[model samples]
Target: MTHTTASTTAFAPITRAACIGGGVIGGGWIARFLLAGIDVKVFDPHPDAQRIVGEVLANAERAYGLLTSVPLPPRGRLTFCATLEEAVRDAEWVQESVPERLDLKQRVLGEIDATCPAQALIGSSTSGLLPSELQTTLTHPERLFVAHPYNPVYLLPLVEIVGGRATAPATIARAKAVLDAIGMKGVVIAREIEAFVGDRLLEALWREALWLIKDDICDVETLDDVIRYSFGLRWAQMGLFQTYRIAGGEAGMRHFLAQFGPCLQWPWTKLTDVVDLDDALVEKIGAQSDEQAAGLSIRELERIRDENLVGILQALKTGHGDRGWGAGKLLGDFEARLAAQVAPAPALDITAPLELVETRVSPAWVDYNGHMTEHRYLQVFGDTTDALLRLIGVDIAYVQAGHSYYTVETHLRHLDEGKLGEELRSTCQIIAVDDKRLHVFYRLFAGPERREIATAEQMMLHVDTKAGRASPSPEPVMARLRPIALAHARLEPPAGAGGIPARRKETAAA
Candidate 1:
């Protein structure tokens, strides 16, 4: 697979997608696409498709929250269909994850060809199946190609796109656009080839790994450790050729290749012969895997794997700049921060009240006016209230210990429209704090101009997070909040100074 120069042209947004299988891989594909804000429809014949897919989605969401630096766009709607035809009927992209059998792929491709629109792209998730073989029976074979992604597709960033003879260059370009928008790195294969790039590399390593295990050179855990602690680190930043080039110390690729070429003929690997998947071998591998991953559930193992991948990828991204594969880095680059201007008084500490939490206006928050929508104003204000609550000892830890706060009601007056790229700052004032409920007023300001954007008045009731009941604010937290709230309360309220105030409707005349 070869990496193409980054293209400036953007493809049409992928609003709707379809998945042909609801197994692990298919479910992961669904989660990734949906979390990137594309609506998805899934088709699978299994009886527990919904339950299984839902579980996978839940795990994917958790992983996404931890791995991604930026908050994900609103999740797309997910639908389960009874048939493959129904699933792809309205989809812009059809992700085929049916079993690895060629006959089954041929059948599914034929069905997709008959049902989906001519312009839609069909992406096969087959690890090694040639695109030509998969599209042999389809009427529009050019629309079908391999978009092979690694297992646990949600975490891995690499997606190899291989085009068959009939596949159009435009189709590959469009597929690359879709992958790029969803924050995945895509490499195009110049021509369709067996096993693609990553798999071929893995196959070479696998042959050697098998030889080691067969000859009792090392156990599974030790072998994994050797790679994780050494080559894995180097590979994260540079590929095989580049790594060796550096090792040659200014001699470059030519010298490295000359030195390593002699080792190719040595009996270092058993790639020429097929390995048997006999019962004994299977049992041995399974037992070794169990021993290696002892006491860890699948979810725990997956989290560890994803975290490691994120850390390594993020480091590479930071070190290499925008050399592609910089999704998290790009997000971090786009982040803007707003800090409170006011300082703490000599007698009191203001750090608790003014600590900033970073958040972005999600695409879903934009209204028809192409600006941050109205309801979102109230939502951000609510978040401000939560921040205040936390400062005043009404935080999650407090709530979980049988104390919490609920928003009784809110009144919002939007003064100005906030659009994309507009940075928002918020300040909260405690109008009143008592035994049962607290009254707070919030001011939302826009950017460096400090223009008033909106104002919100909210009433909150303390409650128990565990018992689902109301309680008083903790005494210590209340003591800390009292001074700040009282100080703000004494200041005069600004009049129509932010942007504009909400207007009231007039009564009908008699």
Candidate 2:
């Protein structure tokens, strides 16, 4: 069971990627690459390929919008190529997601290996076919390997990397590294196998479930309910072995195994056998599944599934205090990566406001009135405040040292409405400052005109967190803050700095 752990810390990101198919999995790969800011070239023979990919991309965009507050990278160019050669020619990575037939896969790999850059790594999205078989027709087969991903590949992050006999070790390493850069967990299986790891487990369970249906023990809906309500929840977070370890209780794995070892010998599962999937069984399963769906379209059901996954992943993110747990930890790490991509704070421009944050309004930020909601305005202003803090050296390390600026008061005025998908930028102005107190004003501008949509005057206090009292900020923080404050002192006071007109307040209520 040799493997590469999903703890790849350092690697170069793929600059360009190519997808050989534009179906569900291929589109997912394209969405992932594009969302990570890598341009993609795609070749799919389907007549409606663009529309299909567009729908998947739309769902992915919606899911990602609700998934995290970390500002995503700007989407890269999506090009639909007329031929596979054109798609793969300059790509740094090429993904083959054609139908799972071995002959088709070999033909595609041959074409890709012949056309793509020699260094390009090719990942086949084969659920079970051995990569060794898929690579047979390629001259440079070293780059071809099984990189199986779960369905709705945009959301679920696991990619099982199974290398063929001809595949180079470097290919496996580089593949995992690339997957990590895109916020996916890729584990390299040391030895190539028939179905790989994830699907093998799924097939075993699926087989038993089918037998139960064939024997009239339970229907498809009941089986799904049993899983979703029970171990499905545990498996999402802790996985199999770890959950069983807890069942061991005081003694752990050794005791738990001793208690349940006898159960393994019993005929509880039909793993070595499978029920015939005849027409009657198919009809029964299909009928039950239709009932379970309750007439929801595939797209509608997919949205529901994606929303549930996002909620679960987010919960995992905050599970262990603020650090995160399981895949949630990976998400937190990915978000940290995204946050790093924020342009570094520039030198303070004291004569005018410092533009602190630039972003687009997320679809979720809008209200039923079709404008950005009330609290989201504060979130943007708060982001500007955070940026200003970083500029002044009040970063995570500084706060962990027992002192931070705590906002004490705020005055906000919304001058214009914000709409979904509107481009936004926020600027910060230093109104006043001292060793222990800082006052700043923020202006939020929307669209190309940079019209002011909102403004907030905030008073913040530097505090010794451990001592529970006001404290002077460290000298490093003050060093950066002093110059900006000194330069801003020469400017005329802002017109509405401390005062709000009654008419303006009345307008806000309206």
Candidate 3:
């Protein structure tokens, strides 16, 4: 495995990163770093190292495109170093994803410690290795920590951060801060243990799953169907404790335990029993797995997995409070950070169409025709209306006060297509405003060329929620809207401003 390294150059301090292996986990680490705009130096002697990492990176890029609307920073350079020493030379953060062998890991860490800068942090990507054992050979063991990430690292946000006895508290804190910057939720393990947290739970369930298969109680497909079709979905969002708490219904967890706790004592599982992976069992599992995959290649299955994860994540991004649920909440925080980094929306530029919303056409917004679906166009335009209302102080608190703007009518005109992942922005120009009625026109633009995609003409009425009827805006609210409306009135009006869009200007897009 040969790799094509980008030209060598100075990298931003902490963002200068390195990976010592290029197999699945290593490649995933590489993808996550590069996508986070961190330069990565990967050293892997495997002849197909480049091919493997490239495939993973391709999938990661696709997943990211579907995952969020916030624009990502430019990709960092990938350098395939000739040696481990060369890879870690300038890396402030080094991740070792070599195969899980004690002697090999010790040798590699010994080599990395001797040559890498003293300030550099070393992370072991071992799923089951004790961080303490890995740190045995390191001269500066304080910097050696465990950073265990799930497969398809770019999509999944959790990374278990474990510090060995020799590892410094500051190292764990620094590692977590770095992980947070790269969009990972760094969960600190209280103690250094083998197969920390996530994998241990997964192993228990996996053991049961294998027993079910080996005992002929269910086929691989049936077992998968049972999981992916039911509790698996529940597990993704609410997770174990919360799901059980919900299962308890109105009585809650104490009641749930009273009802189902006794099942724990039943002869329910072979939790302590180890199943033999003898030839017959191995062949049986392999054949069943092959059938379960149909004709899809490993790469194909990875894509399917990514798509499902992205869909679940996107759904969760819309969950819990103003953020999301579980990993989805982490995702929401990440995007929120991305939004924060951008220059704050310049003081409501009424001089131009008020650029209110910027987003990308996510996968869910696409249709079979390979364009953004019609309703999504309306969704974007509605978002623009909401933004306008908020700018005039019709915020959540304001709405909670029994007052808000309600859209009475809307006229949308589709002018062009919005393909999946296309960059999108909306500009709103107020057309007219009175004590009770406000009319606005919005144009949706796609991509850097600022090509027009669609337009929306809308009228909204301020109402008293308690009275449930149109009402004059409070003076404070009108004070803000009136200034923008007056300024926009001075500008030339949009084409066919006051009426229905002409038939020729319409299309199936919006």
Candidate 4:
């Protein structure tokens, strides 16, 4: 565990992380950090720790790759440490996810607190344990706080940040920034409470579920159906209170509370009653749960769950108004941040079409006809435009500085159909550029043969986004664009690039 290595010496800003306890949560932290291009050092004595980390990383890789269109940072290194000291040796952030035993957590936290630099923050993955208890044995308790991330921590964005009695305000702020950098939404609990917030609601629902099953009111499968098919959809975006507020209709929350307030005293629920967990009850629940899953392995079930969550979340991101709002807005903001972080293209060969975006058709893009849907082609073109802008020095900062290109007109030609899993690459050829307008063409190709699948011709106008009107682009951006445009003019213009295709020959003949 104490072996020295050369790679440990090159830690940069937010570049390295330490995960102690390589169980589900710990391994998930590793995946999140590693995928964010932060090197991760993991410590766990369990024999299967490496295998667990690998499996979790694989799941995370697949899920995150499909989660966003923004380019991600390069994958970081992952190292397994045999002992806790080595794990903490150079990590800027240390996450302790040991079992919930207070004494054990304290022992581990104390060791981390002693070994890690004072500037290095330590976060506990305790579900309900107070930070007061966790820091009791630590020398630098102010730097330790509760950072409760949801299950499958790599995919879920919520992280409840609870600072204890001895926790410093600065420590909480630092924790929030770190969580945000890793693409997580961190909610800082203003006050410490058992079970935090999310878990408390979840525990209540779980208690009710247990009672339901115990009383034979419904089986596990039915319970799941009632949830996922019912309020579960609402809960994802609007959550409980907001959903109920809408239920109030014209009267709003006041009327809703008045109408349903009396239900609080009704004995319709058995939350106060304790269910006895006899062997027979346990066996019955286990068999029913197994029956619900059929014969699918845990990994298979996890993959399905991750895919469904990703699809729902992505849909939520594109929706607003009546559907509701919450994490989706946050996700959109994160995408913007990711877009901003992308480095400009190293160099461009303007003599040819600028290769900007190379991505495969996502499974979500497949339609009932088993081909890439029509709208997705537009989405890919949009991504290609974003990359084109990035290549010519029009980055997030430039856009935020009160000028950006807005696509004003688009004409797409579907030369050939694209199927699911087909690798699609979009290359941009600048047709013309002026201070206020950009005329561009993009060619979409499929697979290694690079067969032309589609082409998009668009006219983009420089706009003051705040004013919602066209404006001249800045001189610096214009300077970069003009040179690239001049260079691209030398190449032959793409055939059928700028015009919508006329009605097919058969339709005309008919």
Candidate 5:
């Protein structure tokens, strides 16, 4: 049950992880670790555990492949072991995602403590069980703590780290470091509290939601819509407090508290009361949820959800139309890390057009016509031009030196539609280049068949950005570009190159 991958960091210990349970959460942990280039050993005794893990991995790969433009490390190996001992034998970290029975959890925690290496950290993925209780039976309990993650653990960045009295401070610090390396935000709770912070707030909301359903105030769908279509969007970036502060006008939080804080005392919410999960109430909720799903399979619903999430998160990356303020900041930071790690494309065909950029049509790229929108085509062309500029030693440093290429004109022609998830590549051929001007033609091809989706002819002028006018290209840049232009000159000229104003063909000898 051991195989290696192509990409891995030299950071020892954290390179390998053991997941003791392979259900949804455990499989998610496996996927996350694997995607981060950490080899994973998983132990799950369920008969269909492998199948389930495979399915989760597929879904995770689909979602995450579109989640960020970050260049992820090559996927790590996934090994399913027969027992927990085999899984954690040489592992540096152990994540236990077993069911939420206290007795079972205690026994398993003790077993892991006895079996795993003494220095290895043990993280229990318990939603509500206190870390104190879980670590009680451990002989070396200092390494045992809670590292609870949200559902779809691979996509969501938050992990709640709660250390019990027996847990050492260094253990929490190391855990946070490992989690951060894997692109997760580990929020360290100061004390061991039942349910921790996120789950406590989530449980309160759940309780109120159930009470509303029980009282026939709203069905499941309506309640969900109310959150998602309104407050849920707000909560993604600004939490309840900040959102309310904005609602208070320019006066801010103090004014907000004065204006609406008294509403908390009113019977506006059912938080004070509890709802009985009787058969009738349960049936009503279940039936409504089922109806809301409209016979879509769980996998189908999951895909739909992942698509919507990816779209929103990617849009936030651009902060399009000034939306996605706070969440956009996180996306931008993640992309910066990705950009730092990404290696430049290697040298390829010198005698032909260089294929500079490749990307898939994301969910956001789609328009009402069921294909990529017009503006997105321009974005791809712009990105293609940027890629070529980078290849020719024109980058941040070059621009900072007050010299850069500014596109003055572009002629674009759309040929075919690009559907969602279609892989697209842009190829650029140098049409002409001089000291202060460069002209290139680009073709966008998409899908496995490589159908030409669009074409663009661009005219760029070298500019001294500080001077705000056209300028001669730097010698270093010309050194790089001249060879590429020479090599590309041998290829057949691209069709539709440099056509701007329409030219009428002469009628044959009328």
Candidate 6:
């Protein structure tokens, strides 16, 4: 596999990005760029640009909130430039998302070429426009190319990177590096091609869809459902070729080809078919679509689409079943990193107690019981413990390298209930420590009031990930944990909370 790494010596910090339009695609480009922590400057003639951009940002924020594994970094500063020149002046990358007009694209490219630095990379979010056509009038055509992304750019992972004949390999590499840094998947096209890969496939599917609707074989809604229920699921994990490979069975590609080759000669579709946008067909499709989504507004539909996309993509990353197209490779990379840092058992230190506290509960944390569930409380506390351990230098990489700690046993007492949106804190202290085991006590408290909410005592063991068994803590790590545990042991334990609720004699008697 060819891998591209960011050049540490010549890396240019992409702090600012410039967008030439503020329409749907432009706005989405701005959101993704900014949400990935790049400052954005946008220029558009429309008077409603500000309001429209604001709405796009709001939607991007909502979609980002659903991602739990990796947190979205802080949003970059957004600015509305009075002129195109001003927007591109200091930008490392400039994205053109204007209307699909060759003249307009040429004009914009010319203006950008005259203003922006020659070294700066320029990308166009055009679905089918060739880079040659778009950069025809540019003096530095090599710097400009197509970076076609799907609608809702913030959620979609694919970005087709197509370069014209004059396009430099270094520029393509640089663009791919930036996109990869922001968690986007970039596929490089060796030479300029019309429609690119995704668009060509989409065009073919769209042609068939139009034919289906026009012939009255299926309505717009039904055609969409056919894709969503069938090919969409298959496409999510594997593309057509790999999916067909599996269907081919043990016979492999040759056998599969022989079986399906006959279908190629069949009149499956009209290669030169075109559907005129007549009033009757338009009304039929529009009415049916409106009826299918009766009560949903545009925003509601967008939310639904984004939610489903996120769920599918996240599921693919988890490698749940039938390893997805490229998700397995990415997940493998992530898991390798995780394995290198996680310890098999928990290790204790006396000098510094684990930073534990009752966590502030969000609306998403509340269960039907109205109080924080037992599992959630453990989750919050566990996260808090992990954070503290990380601060003390025992991180995922540390644990995965066979030099970390794990919880062997846990004892808890629920003294009070926590309501949604309530502020909570947790306190942890190391009570005992040895070469293999570390015992600690944790107290969860309501913030400010310091009222005890829950108490937990846990025994942690030192573990070696490679051996998959308990082991002695490494000498360096042990030295660090010992001092911290000693210091924590000297501090007075908080008053009020007692043993586990079930073990309380009075409660049991009552």
Top model number, lDDT:
2
Write the residue-wise lDDT of candidate 3 on 1-510 in tens digits.
000111112222377898999999999999999977799999999999999898888888867766765545557899998999999999999999999998999899889988899999999988989989988988999999999999988888889999999999999988998988888989999987778999999999999988998899999999989988999999998889999999999999999999999999999899899898899999999999998888999988998999899899988878876568888888887865653443324455666778877767766577899999898888788767766776777765677789988987888889999987778888888777777777788999899899998998987778999999988888898788777777776788787476633233221111
Which segments of candidate 1 are over 4 A away from where they belong?
A: 1-12, 320-510
The TM-scores of all predictions, comma-separated, are: 0.65, 0.88, 0.74, 0.80, 0.77, 0.79
For candidate 5, list the clashing residue pairs, or say none: none
lDDT of 1 by residue, 1-510 (tens): 000111112222688999999888888899878876689999999999999788778767655544543323446899999888889998899999989999998998899889997789999999899999988898998888899987678767578999988888889999998886676667898877789888988998897787677667887899999998999777766767778889877888788788888998898668886677678767776788899999899878876776676676566555654443344454333221101111122232342224222344444356688888776676667656655664555544465467677887777788888765456677665556676667666777776687778887766777766767777666787677667766665566544332222223211110
lDDT of 4 by residue, 1-510 (tens): 000101122222488889999888998899988877798999999999999999888788768756776666666899998889999988889999999999999999999998987799899999999998898998888999999999889888899999989999999998899888777898999899899999999988888898999889999999999999999999998889999999999999999999999999899887777788899889989999999999999988988988988888788888876342477767777667666666665565667888777776655576799988898788788888877777667778877777788887889999898876677788888777766778888998898899999999988878998898988777778777877787777878888774733222211101
Listed per candidate, the RMSD to the true structure in angstroms reads 16.6, 6.3, 7.4, 7.1, 6.6, 7.0
Instruction: Give residue 62's lDDT in candidate 4 (0 to 100).
Output: 66
Model 1 gets an lDDT of 0.70
What does candidate 2's lDDT look like per residue over 1-510, in tens digits? 000111122223788999999899999999988888789999999999999999999888878867876656667799999999999999999999999898888888899999999899999999999998988899998888888988789899999999999999999989999999889999888788889998899999999999999999998888999999999999999999999999999899999999999999999889889699999999999999999899999999988998899999999999999899999999998877765554443454666767777777766577799998898888878777767786777765667778889998889998899887788888777877767778888888899998789889888889999999998777888788877776776666666677422222121101
Q: Where does candidate 3 have its weakest 10-residue lDDT segment?
A: 1-10
Which model scores highest in TM-score? 2
Worst 10 residues of 6 by lDDT: 1-10
Is candidate 2 or 4 superior in TM-score? 2
Tell me the whole-model lDDT of each prediction, alpha carbons only. 0.70, 0.83, 0.82, 0.82, 0.80, 0.71
Q: Could you tell me the lDDT of residue 412 within candidate 1? A: 78
Structural RMSD, model 3: 7.4
Runs in model 2 deviating more than 4 A are 1-12, 345-350, 394-404, 412-416, 449-451, 463-470, 486-496, 499-510
Sorted by TM-score, highest first, which candidate order results? 2, 4, 6, 5, 3, 1
| Native-to-model Cα distance after best TM-score fit, residue 299 in candidate 6, in Å | 1.9
